[model samples]
Target: MKMSNLAVDICGVKLKNPIIAASGTFGFGEAFTSYMDISRIGAITVTGITLEPRLGNPPPRIAETPSGILNSVGLQNPGINYFLDAELPELRKYDTAIIVNINGNTIDEYCSLARILDSHPIDLIELNISCPNVKEGGLAFGAHPDTVYEVTKAVKANTKKPLIVKLTPNTSDIRETAKAAVEAGCDGLSLINTLLGMAIDIKKRRPILANITGGLSGPAIKPIALRMVWEVAQVVDVPIVGMGGIMDGTDAVEFLLAGATGIGVGTANLVDPTACVDILDELKDYMIENKIEDIRDLIGALRI
Candidate 1:
């Protein structure tokens, strides 16, 4: 017997399963098609986009820490038009849902971006409030409850599509941010974005990343992400998309135990673009071995 039925709903969008490839690492959701049947996983969130194309931050934008990598990619992307004209149509060939992750430097930026996708055939609009909020005098919009409320409110009011708020791990109270977004009208929350961290070069006596500090991701952040997911789960009823250094089915299972309805595989994709398929395979085996009839039964079912 197999236990492959792990379908879960996030903001009314039903995924074939709860495991998904996170943005940034998945490259517009088309790059991994040859490695595996793209439709086998849940939904795919494309890399973050902006109103216009971006070259991203300068080189040395990535640094390898002990168990993770620090990146300041600056959300480099080909802009929304490219996605609309090129990526979306091809991706629509599959039955899976394609979500565009949008980032902005200002409130109007968030609203304007939402308006762009308002009538588009996308499944959801994920506001990247984790982008440092200059509107809050350079504080990350996802860092504070107030900023989360305001940004989410603006986007929610502007767009009719399901709005998902991607939260940052830098905050002291992720649960507070989760509640704030929901209060501000967010339909769901994807959390545990890269932790703020840095790496160094002893020979240069300077930081390794050009940005000095960057988002830390990969297996190193899994434990903390799980704890945060569980904590946020206790506070909010909205669906949670848990991610951070998730590299295998076991990692995905850990996130489910922490109350995450869906799991995003980020750095693991970079480690092996095929990790999603392998993780899916492992998940099947684990379910059957445990005598679990359906994977959803494992979600948020940890007994302690």
Candidate 2:
């Protein structure tokens, strides 16, 4: 067995590699055990969990677009307590970093969730500020810098665990949100979440998703995600976890050059359950072929 030394220190969590399973894709980490070597993954970020279990939206929760997927899952989850009691216990059996991705409807909700998980034996906590801001009457917090900082600061007050604020790409200025999160004491950043989009059934003249509008994810959003990663990298000092429509080793490398310390595999996992592990393997090959000894050497290596 050969080790390629692709380790990364993300918000104090030292991962064996730089490839992570994007939130809301890999389930609770146990789901990937049947298809791939789960331990090879740098981390497996669970699906977005709220305070309570949610059945999610109604039928037609997903719409297949030209080159991507539109999802209005309504932040469905098994709930935080279920995760802490059952899922977390199962994940502790493995050595891979277990990242808990959380969402809330209000600032106090964010704070409560953070405080609840503060004592858990988890490696990191990722704040999904992209969730609907109930105080704003359903506007997503990540769409505005003020709400972004508010949620981040609220959560920071409750937990000592590393907090990584995940940002959405629908904002007017992604850099402003990144700066806001960093100033609020976020240990890291992850972007970009799904872009706001809607698909309409021309025959019926109605929206495809149950919620009418859904977040667009996959290859179609890759260009936009990469651009945000580059822009946010210049303004924020924290490590960035970049993902949008990454499916292969090449996409991972592109993110690294864009100044991301790590890359998340989202829609790609649905395409191939072993996506993250395979990406890490391909990354190792790329490093050896390029005469690079460490993966960190490739981060921000891009030049004009």
Candidate 3:
């Protein structure tokens, strides 16, 4: 691996780069191992896991839109027990950091999952309060400030590992949601989860997704994600992980400028399996071109 000024320390966890494969997009970090070197990227957030195995939403779960895509996969996973028994061992083979994204329908469920992962080999536990695909507990818990605080506090109490609260864009005030999570004791924050969106098949006169509505991801939400990250960064003292429509190094750089300690690649992974590695290379090139000695110098460097 060619060395560069891309190393970063997010909440005491060191990353070779700032680019991570966002949750829900990267399935346990196995699918892309053949296409590219997984260790080259900063980190990988596995698919969201629940207390029990989920069959997920019905078919036609994805629809492509202008500059983005909408998905309502519904947090399909083989449950945490299966993950710890089967997936975690295989994922640990890679040299990259493994951060698991966990989802639940209740505060107790969230705490349970956190406690289970606390003693495991995973490097971090990302709370998925922002996922919009589920009917309950996912976005429902994240939409309100009080519920966000309660759930975050509950999970933080159960886990010794670093906790990162993923924030939803559907809420009335993302700042309030971020503040609540921070106050509740999250060590870090990631924003923004896909925006609520829908697509209709005009020929059939119905919605394209079986769930009626899905979360919008990709380039379309970058501006909103950057704005929210900037807003939360101003109010919170913990590190921020910025994501949404980040397709290239420049987009990742934009997030860092807006005050993100790290960046995540989501829909871009669906477009090209090697997107994360490619973006990291480009980031290094940018830093070299700018004569920047350290990537950390770019974090929160955006000037009004």
lDDT agreement with native, every candidate: 0.84, 0.87, 0.93
Clash-forming residue pairs, model 2: none
Report the lDDT of model 2 for residue 256: 97
TM-score of 1: 0.95
What order do candidates take by lDDT, descending?
Answer: 3, 2, 1
Q: How many clashes in each candidate?
A: 1, 0, 1
Q: Is candidate 1 or candidate 2 better by lDDT?
A: 2
What is the number of residue pairs that collide in model 3? 1
Best first by TM-score, ranked: 3, 2, 1
Residues 115-202, candidate 2, lDDT per residue (tens digit)?
9999889888999877431233124678888888888888898999999999888788999999999999999999988888899999
Question: Which numbered prediction scores highest in lDDT against the true structure?
Answer: 3
Q: Write the per-residue lDDT of candidate 1 for residues 45-87, one digit (tens) a residue.
A: 8998888887888878888777798888888899889989998
Which run of 10 residues does model 2 get worst, by summed lDDT? 131-140
